[model samples]
Target: MAGIYLHIPFCKQACYYCDFHFSTSFKYKRELVDALVKEIHLQKNYLQGETIETIYFGGGTPSVLDESELNRLLAAIHANHTVASNAEITLEANPDDLDKAKVNALRKTDINRFSIGIQSFFDDDLLWMNRVHRGDEAESSVKRAQDAGFENITIDLIYGYPLLTDAKWKSNLNKAFELQVPHVSAYSMTVEPKTALASFISKKVYPPLNEQQSASQFMQLTDAMREKGFEHYEISNFCKPGHYSRHNTNYWRGVKYIGIGPSAHAYNGFTRQWNIPNNARYMQSVQQNIIPAEVEELTEENRLNEYIMTSLRTIWGLDLDRLNAIAGGSAPLLLKAARHHFDKGWISQHEKIIYLTQTGKLYADAIASDLFF
Candidate 1:
């Protein structure tokens, strides 16, 4: 089974630290949706007839689209793809966009999962992030989605920002459990170049992020979530049992997926492609039945490094047999390199499958790089 990811590139406003492709203006909204539908038809064969297991609507802000627009896109998908009857359909939504009427309308769609952006339930933190939703709305949004019968819900929380204290971070985790959200995707606040956060720090308008604070809070998050019976299934995700994100899991497992819309990416087990990040350019190309994108053929080394990078960050751990096949007899050398981390108690190997310990997870990126062939 494969997955389809649709990127919605419009937002009500820009978040302070966001560097994702998005337009805060609604000028090209209709044109962009039309382009997306056409692009779906154009790329229908990308998945090569694999049954679609998931359809994900990601963004700039997918929730910004109305019901009619969403239905039109979904209809196109059904017409062009073999979506499974029980396929998981997810829409990423912002709290302010999910009012009573909107949630009710959404329930009528095939979307069974809701990923809400509730970065924090504290007003100060919300302002720090410049999220469109207020603290009360963030809480009420989940309550509203639950009231609308969306049980397979996940909400995002941002930790390690200057405004988020340990107490506040714990409160955020507790709030997810309190609301009975089945899945939670939390992330650290990274200041990408050209983001407002980076700009602020460069001029001393905002305090620089503290690595120690981030590490401390991450440990706190894991401990607190475990107490509440949530599994840290991914390095940046926690969920109740049986509630892991199948869409993201497919990504980590190296499954093929087609990405539609501007700035979206697709991987077909070997070649990786991404659409132009600009809305106008994307629309122009799709209008003429051409997909404007760049493609890269994955070398054996590329695939091996990717497998190591993505697999090492999850609870499932990296599969040794698969790595051995791709390593071209260099697997032994790689394993030798991994022995130091194993001896350091940073990673554990169950004969072949290797998993990072809690301490190792802190240095997951570094560890993966070291193990790369």
Candidate 2:
């Protein structure tokens, strides 16, 4: 089954650390949504009529769209595609947008999953990040969504901000565990170039993220979640039994997906295409019956590298047999080089399947690079 991803490229305000392709301007909202609908129709055949098992409304903050707009987009998608009856439809929401009315509206739809951004559930941390939502709003959002019958909820959390103490990090994790959220995706704060946080660091206005604090907080998270019987299925993801994010899992498993709207990407095993990042240009192009996007045909080496990069990041790891199949038996030397990692106890191999050990997980990206053709 394939997946579909829609990128809504508008946010209420910019987070200090955000580098995502979003603008705080709502001037282009209606046009952008219309363009997204048109793009959906334009790209309907991209996945080759595969049953779409996952539909993700990711962002800029998908919850930013009002109810009617979201319904229109979803209706357009259903009208154009063969969506599965029980597809895992996910909406990426921010805490401030999860009010009673929005939650009710979402519950009325087929959107069965939510990935709420509750980056740090402390007032100080939220202020540090310049997030519009407060600590109370963050907690209330989850409770409100649950009250509105959204049980398949996951949340995003950030750890190790300079303003976030270890105690606060533990509190954040404990809140999720206490609330019995089925899935959690956590990340260590990394300053990206051109972001406000980057500028602040460059000017020594704010202290840098404490790497040691982040590492310790990560270990604390893993241990805490494990104790709560949550499976550390992927490096940054934890889930209760059978509650993994299907859309994200499909991406990790290298399933074909079509991404819609500005700055979105689509892949179908051989070629990858991305829409132009400019919202105004995207709307004009779609209005003129054009799909404003760039495409690239994957070379043999690029395909191998892509597989290595995505597959090695998950618990499934890399399967030599699968790699051979994807490569059509052309790159024996690539798999041959990985034998040393297996011999050195960095990776475990059972016939054609090779997975990382706890130690090897630390060096996963490097190992993948080494095995890349």
Candidate 3:
């Protein structure tokens, strides 16, 4: 099965730490929506008639689109692709955008899941992050969605920022548990090079992120979620059984998917492509029936490294047999590279699978890179 991801590249305001491709202005919203629909038609054959089992509306903020706009995009997908009867359709939303009217409007569509951005339930922390919603709105939005009968709900939480103390982080987790959300995606705050957080740290306006604090909070999160019967399925994701995000799980398992919209990425088994990150250029090219994107043909090394990087982050361990299938004789070298980690008790083997220990997940990226060919 394949998946479809639509990137809505407009947000009402920019968060201080966000570096995703998005426009705070809506001057070209209609044009962009039209271009997205056109792109759907243009990329119809990209998935080669595979049944689309997951349709994800990710963003800058997908909730910004009204009913008509969202319907237009989904309508185009249904017309052009073979979607599954039980497809998981997810809409990424911000708390402030999910008012009563908006939630009721969404109930009219086929969106069976919601991924709400509720970074914190603290007004002071929200202000520090320059988020558009208040603490109260965050709680109320989820309740409103639940009242509207949307049960497949997930929320986003952030940790290890200057304004987020350990106590506050614990409160955030407790609040999430209290909400009875089926899924929770929590991420440590990292200062990307071009984001406001990075600039503030460089200028001494904000303190540098504490790696120790981040590590401690991650342990806290894992322990709490495990105690609450949530599966730590991925490094940054936890969910009640059978409630994982199908779209993102497909990504980790290397399923083929088509991405629509500016700065969105698509991957078939052999090649990967990403759309132009500019709004005007993407719309103009799509208007002319052209896909303004760059593509890369995968090499054997590329495939092996990609698998290593993505698979190691999940509860599913890296399959040594799969590694050797990608390129014969690759597993021995990888095992040699992983010896130090095994000696440190950071990794363990069960039959043909290599899984990260609890401590090893902290160094997952570095270990994967170290094992890369």
Q: Residue 326 error for model 2, in Å?
A: 2.2
Candidate 3 per-residue lDDT over residues 1-373, each given as its tens digit? 9999999999988898999999999998998999999999999988999999999999899999999999999999999998999999999999999999999999999999999999999999999899999999999999999999999999999998878888999899999999999999999998888998889889999889999999999999999999999999999999999999999999999999999999999999999999999999999999999988899999999999999999999999899999999999999999999999999998999999999999999999999989999
Report how far residue 50 has shifted in candidate 1, in Å: 0.8
RMSD of 2: 1.7
Model 1 quality (TM-score) = 0.99
Q: Which candidate should be chosen as best, given TM-score against the real structure?
A: 3
lDDT of 2 at 27: 91
Q: After superposition, how far is residue 139 of candidate 2 from its true place, in Å?
A: 0.9
Ranking, TM-score, top scorer first = 3, 1, 2
Model 2 shows how many backbone clashes?
Answer: 0
Candidate with the larger lDDT of 1 and 2: 1
TM-score versus the correct structure, for each prediction = 0.99, 0.95, 0.99
| For model 1, the run of ten residues with the poorest summed lDDT | 326-335
**lDDT to native, each model:** 0.92, 0.88, 0.95
Query: Per-residue error at 204 for model 2, in Å?
Result: 0.7
* Cα lDDT over the full model 1: 0.92
